[model samples]
Target: MGAAFITPGEIIENSSNLTPGKGTIEHEGKIIAMVQGNVIIDSKSNTVSVKNDDEMPTPKVGDYLIGVVDRLGEKAATIKIIQIEGDGRSILPEHQYADIYVAGIVDRFLPAPVDAMRRRDLVRVKVTETNPVLKVNTRDDENCGVLSALCPQCGEDLYAKPEGDKNVHCPQCDYSGYRVLSNGFGQGYNLEKNGAAAYNRLKQRWSKEFDEIFKAGIPARSVLLRADHRFDGRKITRPNFEGSGGNNQRKERPKGTKLFVGGLARSIDTEKLKEIFSKHGDVIDAIVMTDKETGNSRGFGFVTYSGKASAEVAIKELHKFDLNGRKITVNNADDKSSSKREKKPSGKKIFVGGLDWNVNEKQLEKLFSKYCKVIEVSIPLNRDTGKSRGFGFVTASEDSADKAIKALDGFELNGRKIGVRESENKSKQKNNKNQRSTRELQARREEGIED
Candidate 1:
C-alpha cells in the first residue's frame, strides 16, 4: 500500500530524518514510515489512507457567513456570498455558494444585522437557491454586487422606483440612488443617494404605528373606577335641619330662622359662608349672590340655620365678624307694620316716600317684581297740577306686601332715604280723640252735681 504524505500535527515518534519521502521512524509515540505513493497511516487506530493535497473551497450551507447586502428589494434581499471555507473536492463545490438570494426582507420585520439576537425576538430565515460559480472577466466587475437599501431617514423598509431618467428613487422618502454595493447579508444594498429621506419616512411610520398600538390597549374606564374606589365605605350623618326631635323643641316657627351674616368680605364664597355658620349650628343653606357675568362677590348674603337658637348664636358671633377686610351686619329680619305688611288690604293704602320723580308705576313694578306682584303704584297727584309728587303707593297681596316692606325698608333709591309706614285714616283718628275728650268733660259735670 502507498503511504500518505503527513501534514503538520501528525503524531510521529523516535524518527530522526522526518522528511516528505523518508523511511520508517518513531518520533513521539506514533510511527512515521515512507510509503510508495500518497497515503495516510493512523498508527494509533491502525488505519491507512491516501493523501489528497487539493485545498477545500470555502462556501457551505448551515455555516455562518459574512456578506454585504447588495440589492435590497421589496420582496427579497439579494446577497452576493463572497468568501467560503471548505474542501476543494466536496460533492457541493464551494464556488457554487456565491450570489445567494434571500426573499421578503421588506415585508417581514427583522432586526438590523448589527443587533445581537435576543430571546424575545424571532429570527426567521429560508435559503432559496445557490447560484453556479462563473468565471469573471474583470476584478472591477466583481465589485458590482447587490446592496440593501436601509432608510437613511427612519430606518424602515424602503421601496425602489425609477427616477426621471437614469436614477432610482426610494418610494418611501423620495431618495434617489444609482450606485450599488454589497450589504452585510451579501445581497441587500443601500442606494447611493436619498438614503436620508428614506430613513425619515421609515421613522415616521414606525412612530405612528407605535402610538396607535399604545393607545389602543389603554382602558378608558380605569381612571373613573380608581377615583370612585378612593372614597368607598365613607359615610356621613347630620340632623335634619327642619325636622322636630323632642318636646323641648320650640314650637316650629311659622317662619324659618333667617340668618344675617355681615362680616364677610366680598371675597368670601358660599362655601366659606356655610362653614362659618356651621360652627354655631347646622345651617340649612348659605347663598352668596354674585354678578353672573362678572363673577364678583356681592357685599351681602343670607344663611338659614337649622333652628332659632343656632340662628341667634350665628347672628351674635358673626354680626360683627371681620371677613375679607370688612365688618358685616348680622341680625334678625324685622317685621313690617300690619297695614303696610298686608299684601291684600280691605281699604288700607300705604304711602311710599323718597321716590325719584322720573320713577313710574312700571319702574316700581319691575323693582318689586322679585318679592311680590304690585297691583298698583299710585302717585298722589295734586288737583292743581297733573305732575307726580315724587312718591307712590305699591299695593300687593298681604303676604307679599310684608315681604316687600321688609326687603325695601332700608334700601336706597335715587340717593334718598325711603320710608314705609302703616297707612291710617286721619279724620277717623281725630274724631275718636275729640269724642273721648267730650265724654271725660261730661263725667266731671255729673260728679259735681252729685257732690
Candidate 2:
C-alpha cells in the first residue's frame, strides 16, 4: 500500500505501457504523476495510481458534482468534473476529465442530451458511486448550469435562448450550440480572450485546484492543455546577451534597427560617429567598420537606434553629411546595399590611363570589344580645345577587365604606351596610410566601397 510520494507532473514511471489510474495522467508517451503522492504500480492489474495523503476529491454516493461537458461519444459523454459540492474538493485544470456513461445522463429514455448539453458547457451532476472509476449523473438538478462558452467560429459569446429552441446562439454571428443552460448562460459573461472582464475573471478567480497547478510551474509543452494557462517566470531558455554589458549596461537596439553607414572617413571611430549621430536621435549602438586582424576603420560602419522613428530621423538628417571630413551616407541596414546592388556593381570597371589623346569612345570600344563584351567606353574631351583628356575609361565585363589588364597594360598602342588596370572609385577612400596602424582598410575596399 505504501508508495513513493512525488510532486505534480513528476515522472512516476518512464513506461506508458501501464494504465494511468485515479490521480495519474498519461502525457507525451509517459505516465506522469498529477499530484504530490505515492507512485503506486500495481503489477497484477498493470495499473498506476498517484496515492497521496492530500484530501483529493473522492466520489461518494448521491454527492453533487460540478463539471464541464468535455465531449460526447456514442455510448457516453466525458465530463471534466471540477467541484464536488459539500466535500470541499475541486477539479483542477491539470486534473483530467472523467467519463459519464449514457445510462447516468438525465432523461434516460431520450436518445441523448440533444439541444441540451454541448461540449465545453459546464454542468452539475450526482455521483453514482461506480466501480473501477467514479461516474456521475446529471439527470436531476435545478441548480446545475452552463457557466460560459463562445461561438466555435467567430469567438463571440454564445447567448442562451430561454424561450425558443432553447439552444445557445451567437448574437453577433450565425452560430449555435446545444446546451442545457441554467440562469447563468448569457448575461454578459464569456471566456473569449477579447472579453476584458471575462479574461480578468478567469485569471483572478480560478479555484484552489487551478491555483495549485498554476504554482506547480508545469512544463511549457503540456501547459496549454492545463486549466490555468498563466506563466509568471522566465522560460528555461536564457536571454542571449545577459551579462555582456560592461560596468554600465548598455541598451541594445533591435536587430533590424541598425543602419549601415557607408562612404565614411577612415579617421571616424565608433565614439566619434555616435557623438555626431546622437544629436538626431538616441543612438543605441555605433560601430565603425574595422579590419578583423588589424582593428582599423574600413571607411564605414553601422549605427543603431532603439526605435524605428529614431533611425528614420537619423537617416534623414545625417545622410550625405560631412563626418570626420568624408560625406557619410546613412541608410537602414536592409536598404543600405540592397538598393545599391540593383545598380550593377558586382563586376569590375576597367580604367584606361595614358591615352594617345587622339582616341575616341568608338576607337576604344573597337579595341577592347575583341576581348569581352564592352558595356561602355568613355574618352573625355575639352570643349574649348576639342582634344582627348589624356585618359579614358573602358567599362567591360569582369572577366574582360582581367583580360584587358593583362594584355593592354603598359603595351604600346597608337605610338603611346597605354596603362590599363581595374577602375578605382577614389572618392571615399581617404588613403589612411598614415592615420590607422592597428588594422588595414580591407573590409569593403577590396569589394569597392566607393561603388
Best by TM-score: 2
What is the C-alpha lDDT profile of model 1 across 90-119, one tens digit per residue? 322234323322212222122221111111
Give me the runs in candidate 2 sitting further than 4 Å from their true place.
1-5, 8-34, 37-53, 85-95, 101-109, 176-178, 183-451
> Model 2 residue 197 lDDT?
22
Q: Give per-model CA RMSD.
A: 39.8, 23.1
- Model 1 ranges off by over 4 Å: 1-255, 334-451
The true-structure Cα RMSD of candidate 1 reads: 39.8
CA lDDT of each prediction against the hidden true structure: 0.45, 0.62
Q: Per-residue CA lDDT of candidate 2, range 177-243, in tens?
A: 4454444344422333322122112112434533343344323212222321223322222123333
